[model samples]
Target: MERGNRIIYNQDGKIILQTGETTGDVSGHDTITELHYLDVEYGSIDYNKQHIESINPITKELVLKDIPVILTDEQKRLKALEEELSMLKEENKNRDSEIVNTAFEVVNMKLNNNI
Candidate 1:
């Protein structure tokens, strides 16, 4: 009869498989004996808005404490360019609306004068 391997906990609460040394079934084991799975969902982090402040070893939870976003010079310049582009696009839209309104007013005036 073959004796199946049994799991045993060491004094440090580490799991050890009792496999005969002759069978060569024993391998290295992890020190973490108990790991509770968390059902929490983690969202994609925006480095500009959030930063990892610390991590809990036992729970393996990431602590995201809000702090001032650190950006490189190039990143700062790029952000400024994006803001400027948005403002310019808004101004262009307003100008186009104004031009359309002026054209309509001119057409109405011409119609009134002709009548």
Candidate 2:
């Protein structure tokens, strides 16, 4: 989420913070430029909290849990669209090849008939 922020400007003379790749130009009616992510340097404290259960008992269990990452709905939709586009492109390629082959065959047949 942190890497998804971009700066945007509005018609009302207000600056907006869009949390994604931003489109549109700074001045309206102009060509849109490719957007880039804003790099941010984060501050951090070099410290940690270390605690033991039962006043430092003979044995203790420290469980580390990691959250699972899942794809966003938009990402899923885009992936599906990409697959569909790829399939369409493949179909078009096959159709074009067939048309070319048919044309070649027709030309060859005409040449043979003339001979």
Candidate 3:
């Protein structure tokens, strides 16, 4: 019995799964069970970040792994600035709350003196 249609690899060993292009099949191709994408919260994995770590022989699934990236100097600086901006926003929110409370207290004092 045939398991399934095996994935076709080009001369460079890259998988050819194009939409319309047709390539003749040859022998010695692996039947890929599943193709996985990197699961991360911050950003979707791009081509540069995607690395094929290994393929499970039993499962016939290609494992996708994340490649560690070192941030450039400009990237590091931008990140620092973002963090500082977040902290400043929080500080402003707290100050606004304090100002409103002080204003309420002063108004209450004036009302009591008039009473």
Candidate 4:
């Protein structure tokens, strides 16, 4: 069995979504029955949702009459930024813990006259 992808587009020539399906032999009639949209700029398909309006049998491409409202690039960037910020916050927490441990070690050394 081999996997296949169907690129779906809108009437305005903009991509809306895409779907993935696998093809099988006679005994294995497994196949993809969903639509996927192509991200022309990113050169990849968005598989987050199926937004197929129709299928163009002649061209073997899926079509959509209206594009779905998804997160814009700005929103995606913001999400990424938020994730990074969360990671940094966790890192800072670890750093703060390390600082506190170092301070404790210093205090113990001074009490033992090692400082």
Q: Give the best candidate by TM-score.
A: 3
lDDT of 1 by residue, 49-79 (tens): 8787767877789788776768999999999
Local accuracy of candidate 2 as per-residue lDDT tens digits, 1-115: 1233455777696876655544555322334574333332343222233222222123333332334457799999999999999999998998989999999999999999994
lDDT of 2 at 71: 72
Cα lDDT tens digits for candidate 4, 10-99: 779896666666676623333658645443335233545435576676676767454566899999999999999999999899899999
TM-score against native, each model: 0.37, 0.27, 0.43, 0.28
lDDT of 4: 0.70
Question: Scored by CA lDDT, what does every candidate get?
Answer: 0.73, 0.59, 0.72, 0.70
For model 2, which pairs clash?
none
Query: Which stretches of model 1 miss by more than 4 angstroms?
Result: 1-30, 42-80, 90-97
Among all windows of 10 consecutive residues in model 3, the one with the lowest summed lDDT is 19-28
Candidate 2: regions farther than 4 A off = 1-69, 101-115
Candidate that scores best on lDDT: 1
How does model 2 fare in lDDT? 0.59
Candidate 4 worst ten-residue window by lDDT: 36-45
Ranking by lDDT: 1, 3, 4, 2
Better of 3 and 4 by lDDT: 3
Model 1 Cα displacement at 6 (Å)? 17
C-alpha RMSD of each candidate structure in angstroms: 11.0, 20.8, 10.7, 15.2
- Candidate 3 vs 4: which has more TM-score: 3
In model 1, what lDDT does residue 14 have? 92
